[model samples]
Target: NRCEYCGDENGPFEIHHVRKLKDVSKGTEKWKQLMIQRKRKTLVLCKTCHTDLHRGTLPDNRFAA
Candidate 1:
């Protein structure tokens, strides 16, 4: 597989949620409402690519947060 963002080899890549789970899981019906309302996105990324995305060093991509 290839890193969805950079097109680099994605060996043992991980599925990453665009939005943080903690924020997604707020504490009430609002959370459920948000889940229902929003189109949650995820990415299949290699460890290095994943790290870069979080560190804000990589250009944004559709698959990345």
Candidate 2:
């Protein structure tokens, strides 16, 4: 499977979830916005992407991080 955020075809992936619309809106990151725009509650991220997301930094969608 590939990462939903970074398009990584590797393993060690993590699923990041946002349960609340308000909480999702509070985030301005591209990934977060994507989740909101698609009306999804989860994002499958590679290790690097997951780390970047927690650090408030993530690369653009469908890019290799």
Candidate 3:
């Protein structure tokens, strides 16, 4: 499959989590459940797009707060 962001099908791809694990609260059960649910939400991105995403250059809607 192609990357959802840049549509690159070249090299390797990575599964980028829509919600960061660190942002989820670990103290509450509800938050924990939410964290688990969030884990299932991910986006496939190419290596370049993934790097751009982490560098805050790619304007992916999934990473928007």
Q: Whose TM-score is greatest here? A: 2
Using TM-score, rank the candidates from best to worst: 2, 3, 1
List model 3 lDDT by residue over 3-22, tens digit each. Answer: 76556777598977746555
In model 2, the runs with Cα more than 4 Å from the true position are: 61-65
lDDT value, residue 35 of candidate 1: 40
Model 3 regions more than 4 Å off: 20-40, 59-65
Worst 10 residues of 3 by lDDT: 27-36
* lDDT values for all models: 0.54, 0.78, 0.58
Local accuracy of candidate 1 as per-residue lDDT tens digits, 1-65? 77655566736686667465455455343322334355455556777766765675644443432
Better of 1 and 2 by lDDT: 2
Please provide TM-scores, in order, for all candidate models, with all chains considered together: 0.48, 0.79, 0.53
Encode model 2's per-residue lDDT on 13-62: one tens digit a residue. Answer: 99888777678887767887878887888888888888988887676654
Query: Which of the two candidates, 1 or 3, achieves a greater TM-score against the reference?
Result: 3
